[model samples]
Target: MRQSDKKASFIELGKFLSQFSEKGNHLNPEVKNNDRFFDNFVSLIELSQSHNGWFTPEQVYFSVQSWAEALTESNLDQWLSRYDFTNITSKTVGLILAGNIPLVGFHDFLSVLISGHKVLVKTSSNDQKLLPFLAEYLISVTPEIASYITFTDGKLENFDAVIATGSNNTARYFEYYFKDKPSIIRKNRNSVAVLNGKETKEDLVNLGEDIFRYFGLGCRNVSKLFLPKDYDFKLFFEAMYEYGDIIHYEKYANNYDYNKAVFLMSRFELLDNEFMTLKEDTSYASPISSVFYEYYDSADTLKTRLEADKDQLQCIVSNAVITDSIPFGKTQHPELWDYADNVDTLDFLIKI
Candidate 1:
């Protein structure tokens, strides 16, 4: 299939996704193949939590809507305009997707195909349903796309290159196993927010969205906060109050109770707001239901530190106070060009 064909198929898939939301699912008769796929898609979203407790309907709907906005014709064209696919040869790129959040690895899947390559996907068990369902929708829209996609339940073979997302431990295994083959092996990285004690209550409340979205499972979610020395917690906690309903989710509440009990038992000081806890720590990866915070004395020194530790971070959220920092709540709303791990996936694919 031509590149234009692939792009058009994705655009249709996006329109199909735009119909489903937290408010309700509306049937758009103009959307192609909706009569066959729409009802099943809704059923899958409702059944998502049964497969993975974290895949609640609200979270899944948010992810679906995010993709709906991303796969527009203009966005796809802008993202691909810089690449030259004239001399490309189709190679089967293997994808080992991570399922921490809904459609966490969809970008890689899109990159492989959109770059004039076939994709052999190994879906993460936690996210098997959603992507495959969408893949079916894409095939329905463009039958030729079927030849370009494959899913496997066993070991991956007959692939020229691979892109694998996993923990730091699995990264080592991927490096050793795929050493001879060109690959992009991703490791765990966390996002952090920098507060200069000058942010508005609205900014901090939006930061709550960055923290609570996907229950903080995504790499883009801000798991830690960098606050100025002696920064008051009064306003921060109050801003976070908007998301107090998050505690009502049984799984999140269980995590809150368990982690809080463990913290208390360890005699550690914590700033608790019933729904979430803030702890003083130097780590980037915080557990669910809690956020780790650290105090910095100087913006210059903190910038230097964060720059040196860039490899361990996914995003740095700020009000543009820090270099290359994303806005408060926009971490999860990454554009097509916001390459993960700061590695250009399309560049890697085209060269291979």
Candidate 2:
């Protein structure tokens, strides 16, 4: 299939996804294959939590809405405009997806196909339903796309190159396994926020979205905070109160109770607000229902530390206190070109 045809099919898939939202499902008569796919898609969204306890309707819908906004003609054109596909030879690229958040690996899948290559996807068992369902929709829109996409349940085989996402442990195995193939192997990384005491209430409230979105399951979620010395937790806690209802969910509440108890027993000082706890720590990866914070004396020194640990971080959220840091609350709403782990996935696919 031509690249234009693949882009058109994805745009159609985006339109189809635009119909479902947390507010309500609105069917558009003009969307192709809705009669065959729309109702079933709604049912799948409702049943997503059963497949994975973390895949709540609200979280899934947020992901759907984010993608609906991303896969537009303008966004696609702008993202793809930077690449040259003239001399490309189509090759099969295997994707081992991660299921931490809904459609976590969709970008890689989209990248391989948009670069005019076949995609052999091994969907994470936690996210097996959504992508394949959309793939079926894509094939329905452009029949040729069927030959370009495949899903395998067993070991991946017969692929020219590979892109895989996993934890640090599994990444080691992937490096050894795909030793000879061109590859991008990803591992666990966390996002952090650098804060000065002068943040407005609105800014901090938006930061709550970065902290609490998807229950902090995604690599882009802010799991750590860098605060100035003697930083006041009162306003920060007040801003976070906007998301206090997150504790109402059984899974999150359980994590809150358990992690809080573990901290209390360890005699660590905690700043708590009944729903989530704030602890003083240096680690970037924090448990669900908790956020770790550290005190920084110098912005220059902190920047140097972050730069030294760039590979361990995915995003740095701030209000321009740190150079190249993303704005508050926007970590989960990454653009098409905001490649994960700062790796250029399209360039990798094209070269392979």
Candidate 3:
């Protein structure tokens, strides 16, 4: 298919996705594949929790809404404007997706296809349903797309290059396994927030969204905080109270109980609000239902530290308090140009 055709199909896919949301959902009759895809997608959204307990309709819909806003023609055109696709070849790109939150690997899948390459996807077992269902919708809208997309359950084979996402351990294996192929192998990276004591209640409240969205399962979710020395967390805790109900979920509550117990047994000081725990620790990758924090005396020193550990970070949320840091609550709803790990995926795909 031509690049224009590929872009048009994704823009339509975006419109189809725009119908579903956390508060409301409606199928637009004008959408090309709605006759067959509408009802089935609603069923899949309902069945998503059964497939993976984390894929609740609210979270799934949020993911859908984010993608819907992102895949617009304007966004696609602006994001792709820097690339020249004239030299692109129709090579097959193997995609080993991650099932962390919803559609975590969709960007890579889109990148390969939009660059005029075939995509051979191996869906993460945790996220097997949603992407394939959408792929079917895409093929329905643009029949030519059926020739460009494939989902495989077996080991990936016969692909010129690969994009894989996994934990650090799996990354080591991917490094050795795809040694010869042009590839993007992602590892576990977490986002962190740098907070000054001057933050207003609303700033801290929005920060809660950064922490609790996706139940802190996504790499973009803020798992840690850097507080100014002697900063009181009373306001921060008060603001985060809005998300206190997250503890009602079995998985999050289980993690809260387990991690809190482990911390208690280790005699670490913890600040608990009956739902989430705040601990003074240096780790960037905190467990669910908990956020680790560290006190810094100097912003310059901390900025230097963050720069030194950039590879361990997916985002740095602040009031632009640190260089290149994103504003609070914007981490999860990244723009198309916000490449993960600062690696330009489109550049990788085009070159390969």
The TM-score that candidate 3 achieves is: 0.99
**What is the Cα-based lDDT of residue 341 in candidate 2?**
95
Model 3 clash pairs are: none
Estimate, for each residue in 197-223, the C-alpha lDDT of model 2 and write its tens digit: 999999999999999999999999999
Backbone collision tally, model 1: 0
Per-candidate Cα lDDT values, in order, are 0.95, 0.95, 0.92
TM-score: model 1 vs. ground truth: 0.99
Error of 2 at 118 (Å): 0.6
Per-candidate count of clashing residue pairs (backbone under 3 Å): 0, 0, 0
Candidate 3 minimal-lDDT segment of 10 residues: 25-34
True lDDT of residue 46, candidate 3:
84
Q: What's the lDDT for residue 300 in model 1?
A: 95
- Give per-residue CA lDDT, model 3, range 261-330, as digits (tens): 9999999999999988999888898888889999998999999999999999999999878988888878
Candidate 3's displacement at residue 217, Å, is 0.6
For model 3, the stretches where C-alpha displacement exceeds 4 angstroms are none
Model 2: CA > 4 A from native = none
Of the candidates numbered 1 and 3, which has the greater lDDT value? 1
lDDT per residue, candidate 1, 1-352, as tens digits? Answer: 8999999999999999999999999999999998899999999999999999999999999999999999999999999998888889999999999999999989999999999999999999999999999999999999999999999999899999999999999999999999999999999999999999999999999999999999999999999999998899888999999999999999999999999999999999999989999999999998999999999999899999999999999999999879889998898899999999999999999899
